[model samples]
Target chain A: MTLTEKVLARASGKAHVQPGDNVWVNVDVLMTHDVCGPGTIGVFKREFGQHAKVWDQSKVVIIPDHYIFTADSMSNRNVDILRSFVHEQKLPYFYDVIDDPTGEWKFDASKGQLERQYGSNYTGVCHTTLPWKGHTRPGEILFGTDSHTCMAGAFNQFATGIGNTDAGFILGTGKLLIKVPETMRFFLEGALPLGVMAKDVILHVIGEIGFDGATYRAMQWEGPGVYSLSMDDRMTIANMAIEAGGKNGIFPCDQKTLDYVNERVAENGTKSEFEPVEIDAAQVFSYDKVFDLSKLEPTVACHPDPGNRKLAKELEHIHLDRAYIGSCTGGKTSDFLAFAEVVRGKTVKIDTVGVPATTKVVRELKEILWGGQSVWQILQSAGVQLTENASCAACLGGPVDTFGRLNKPMKCISATNRNFPGRMGNKESEVFLASPYTVAASALTGRITDPRTFMS
Target chain B: MAHTVTSPVYVVRDNIDTDQIIPAQYLTLVPTIAEEYVKLGSYALIGLPDALYPKRFISEGDISTPYKIVIAGRNFGCGSSREHAPIALGAAGVEAVVADGFARIFFRNCVATGEVYPYDSPVRLCDVLHTGDVATLDFDVDTLTVGGTVYSLKPLGEVRPVIDAGGIFNFARQSGMIAGEAPSH
Candidate 1:
């Protein structure tokens, strides 16, 4: 059996399973955010009675990462509902936004104290924070309310998203009936060219396979190139699996996964006893199909469809009015490092926006120096509009009043996932999905230019 | 438990995501309120395609418009697991959807909510069915008649009961999966 089958079988307490076979699997974790959590709670109450409690409080994680900082009353009300639900249930894993109560700036650098006491309870971009906070583990079955919950599959887990009603049922039953998805393996065998990142590789794959090419299948990455990718890069690939109609995208666990999890756990001042999941050598040949990504180039998904990809060098004539470099798919630390490499010492010619995935990433950015100044300061000086709060702002093409919303029709090159119509803002606006390197390069050149031209 | 209907087929291309079905901007409406849902449903498929399709499911300046069936290409609902997509369509009077394929989550949502009958076509239904073409769908016989041709639809299998009971919650309650009077709320 494939890795996905093995994991699902183990979770379901079955010795074997096949594609299209439905089984009730035990859920290790269930996550929801402000946008869907309130609806899930409503469904839970309506179906299971008002006084019903979740099956397990510790296994549930709730975060209000979307629409938190917006002035929309409905968005704020959703967060309030989640807060009251957390209070009523006494849930331990709720990550709420922290506000400086005293509003005083007293710096004690020697004591490692900053001016404002921004509490550490918040978890920005739940997909990125899940692994940072030690919620994702190999061989586990995790579920979230967001489509990109498949991002957790980078840790070699079977993770996917469900609708509010299914989530409510899971909340009450602690289990889900899922059909085992067949695995489609992609053997990445060559080294990516300089300035080409995992985002480009995935976009190339999506281009080869249209949006519905891998419907109801698990996309498994393997071989030398897959092993060579950083966890951030792997997460970027897994996060956009749904864009290609994949059930999930997974990379088998290796030393890199273990090392990253260990470092994150240590940074949190905790000792983790989590062990890496072992795979059978004979199970490697069980993939239903395989694709090769040896000759891939820096690619970009053009307006309206993520599968409508072209080589970055082929689309240099397309001018960009805005460049955004942030999201669960592109807002990691390594993504920023790549962005800085291309944007260093260059002024942006277009409206650029940069947002770190998490608060921890923000703290790390403050300590890094770029051109004799903090990386954050350098980006700001380069005319990149950095939002203060970390949330899913404008990624979903929210209402007109949303921050970073496309007020007028303009072409944009974004590092985020999905380029569906009206995805980033105005319905007439065109969005090109690319890597941070490509986005940064395009921002400097005001067009979709390949990063290799700008790289040192 | 099953019924047949004939209506004019509204053709849409592939990958009609939930975001396009009902943008996240209108997701705040309470799901239990019919008027709120009807108001939110008015904007279904708004700003999606330029021409060759009806931009809005609910007619402008009028709340009631007859639209019973939608025929689409492959992967009819491919992004996001928002039930609001089906809710908006159902409220807009879309009774059934026929496509070459569907995203698993959306297909399940169709069965769980009983809001729309999701049928799979062997061939690209969008290619065979055209806008304003009268199509007949028989759930009992699992066949679709469009453009003077009869096509067999993939059987619903175990999903039929969920739709027959008018939703998953109703099926679960009636089947004794849960013990209690179904909560009215």
Candidate 2:
């Protein structure tokens, strides 16, 4: 049995379980964001009734991240709906944009300016913030309404996305019927080459597997290569599990996971009783398949499909109209650090955007100095358009007029996941998915240049 | 209890994600009212190539076409876990989807919403079924008959009741899992 099977078996209250066995497992946490939360609330009301209480208030988390900073009335209304629902239900875990305790910035509707408030409250991207807030833990079976929710699996938890209907049902029942998925383990051995991050490794994996290769199966990552990755890198790999049609992508809990969680807890000045779930030694075994990533090059998933990947060096002929580095997949602190390293003193030739994953990331960027300026300041000085705090900006391709939107038919090199047609904006526009290193390098060169060309 | 449908299947290739079913731009058009939602059903698979199938799922003047079944390749509904995808298909009068395989969330959404019945074809349905190919689906025996040959389908198993009850909520209501009058907002 693999670690995935062991986790499911325990969650389902069975001594052993096999693939295709349907089991009703108790859920520990449920998350919904602005884009999906309103729809989920509507479903909950329609099916469970308007006044029906959620199964467990404390266990439910709502974050209004996507479409929050947009001027669109519908997007704002979505956040309003979530706010009202959160208030009406008195949900304990609603993280609003205004909830940022830093109080450094506030969106002033009247002046259309981000003003300083004494004490503001806001949580950025839910995936980045959830683990930071201790909403996700090992051994827990969590469900979210966004496809990227599988990202929490980096904590060794069984987390995946479900539709609004299932979310409503889980809200009412606190249980979801799931078929135990066959696990497909990828044993990534050997250290990644310089200028190659987890994003490159995952892009390589997705390209090899195609978009649907791992459909309906648990994608588990293991081996020494996994240990070489940072927590942020691990999150980046797990975040795009859905890109390969995987049910979930997970990494077994390790010291890195523990250290990251502990540091986050300490930084937040909050106490958590959360303990990392222990792995059963008997469950460890040979993986389904293994890939040596030592020689892996910086890879990019070309236009139209994330599975259409090529070595970044091979794509230097492709010109970029825009370059973006942000999203759950590449908007972490480390991602920004990597981006800054590449574009340190270079001026971007094309439109470039850098959005931190959360408020904490922004704070972290302020600590790093590049060329006598903070990382964020240097990025802005280097002609990178940085957004306030964090949100799923153009990753989903917002309104035609939204910043970072693919308004025109042009090519863009992005660090975000998913390059499906019309994914970032205009259907005619093309998106190349790459790592922050590659994106920054491409942004400086206005072409798909490999990070190694500039890194050394 | 069983349901049967006979129609010319519209064949779509592999990995038909929710984004392709209906792009994010169209999601805001999905109204909360069921009636209004169905009105936008014509937009189902709107992003797909028009040259492939000349007739739209929902035709001009908001009239729906006659295609009731969609035969697809593997990993159908692989992307975003949006109920709107299934809802749009259901609204477009698509009664069932026959695919080589399905993404887990999309499969569960089909069962939970009871909007569309998803049948797993043992053989690649895309290769076996084609546009204007008359096919019959029998939910009772879990089989799809194309031309003169019949293909066995994966059984719904425990999910049958939920599908039979027209969704998980209905099943739960019937089984006494939810008791009491619908809450007034």
Candidate 3:
């Protein structure tokens, strides 16, 4: 059996489980954010009862991230609704944006786009926060309202997104009926080249097999190349599993996963008892596909869809008006380090935006130095508009006032995930999805340039 | 439980992600709110580029659409786990969606909410049928008739009971998984 099967089998309280079997599994965590938290809470109340309580307060995690920095009233109201729900249920894991219990929390735009909302319980994106807050554990089943919840599978756990109805049911029962998915084995061979990133690796796989390639299937990455990657790299790859319509993307839980999970769990004082799933000696991968990491170059997913793959050199002629580096997929310390490596002493030709995924990452930007300067200072020196407040600014194109949002029909090379029409803002705008290396390289020039140009 | 739907179809291309179904800017309107639920329908498929898709899924100044069914190519309702996608379609009175294939989350959301009957068709209905074509979906015989041509649809099979019971909550109540909860409207 694969790692997914083993994890699900344990969660479902079965000795052995196979693909295509329908089982009800106990949920360790159910996450929701501002975008879907209000809806999920409403469903939970309607189905369970007007005054009903959630099954487990500690098991439910609410993060108010999306649309938080916008001046939009409705977005603020949604966060308020989540706040009310958290207070009503006394849910302990909520990361509140405002101190006030009422719905009067407003985005003070006069303070500037990146300022304000300082030093609150606000943790940026939910996917990134899940790991940092130690909500992610091996051999646990986590269901979140947001699709990128699959990002937690980097811890070798079974995590996927569910709709509000399913989430609501879980709120009452703490159990969800789910069908076990078949696993698609992806073996990454050879060490990753200097210019290449996990974004390129996943883009190549998604391009080889269309956007719907892993639909209803689990993508499990293995081989020696898996160990070569850092936890952040694995998170970046696992985050975009949904781009290929994958149920989840998983990696082997090695020392890196253990060390990261242990530190976070200890720091956050979360439940530390978790049994990690291991592969048996007789285990076999039914469907195997290998990707040569060394053979890869800086790749990009062109406009309209993430499956439209092309090498960076092939698209160097494509002019770009903006370069954005942020989101759960690309807005990490590692990704920023990659960007800083390319654009250390150089200036950006086009408008570039940098948003850290979490407050922890925000500190890392100020602390981690490149050459002699901090990453934040280096990016600011390079004329990148860096946001002080860490949140999903324009990765999904929130409100009109969202920072880094492509409001016009401009061409943008982004380090974010999806390039679906209207994904990052205007439907007419063309977004080229690439890694931080490619985006940073493109920022130096007003065109999509190969990161290899700066690497060597 | 065998019902038939006869209505004009709204056509769309493949890879119709949730963002196109319902854009992120409007996601602030949670579908669980009845007032926002109706508003969500007003903007269904509003994210489709004006140049590529000239015909709007929901006409301007209207909350409910004239068309009752959607015809889409492969990989329909892709991207994001936004249940609002299917909810918006259902709110717009889209009774069913016939497509070549569906992304996993969207298809499951459609079934879980009982918002729309997501039918998998053997043939590419988007290519075969035109937008605004009058079509009839007969679940009794498991066939879709458009312009006098009949197309077979894959049976809902295991999920039939859930949709018939009007979503997972209702199905759970009927199966004694949980008691005292009213069915979804």
Model 2 is docked with a DockQ of 0.49
Residue A221, candidate 3: alpha-carbon lDDT: 91
Clashing pairs in 2: A98-A121, A99-A121, A99-A122, A100-A120, A100-A121, A100-A122
What does candidate 1's lDDT look like per residue over A188-227, in tens digits? 7767777889998889888877887778888888777888
Compute each candidate's TM-score over C-alphas: 0.93, 0.91, 0.98
Docking quality class, candidate 2 = medium
Q: CA lDDT, every prediction? A: 0.80, 0.80, 0.89
Clashing pairs in 1: none
Two-way TM-score contest, 1 vs 2, winner: 1
Q: Which stretches of model 2 miss by more than 4 angstroms?
A: A99-119, A266-271, A284-287, B29-32, B49-55, B60-65, B127-134, B143-155, B175-185
Write the residue-wise lDDT of candidate 2 on A142-181 in tens digits: 8999889999989888889998888887888898888888
Interface RMSD of the candidates, in order:
1.6, 2.3, 1.0
- Please tell me which predicted candidate would have the highest TM-score against the true structure: 3
Per-model DockQ against the true two-chain complex: 0.58, 0.49, 0.85
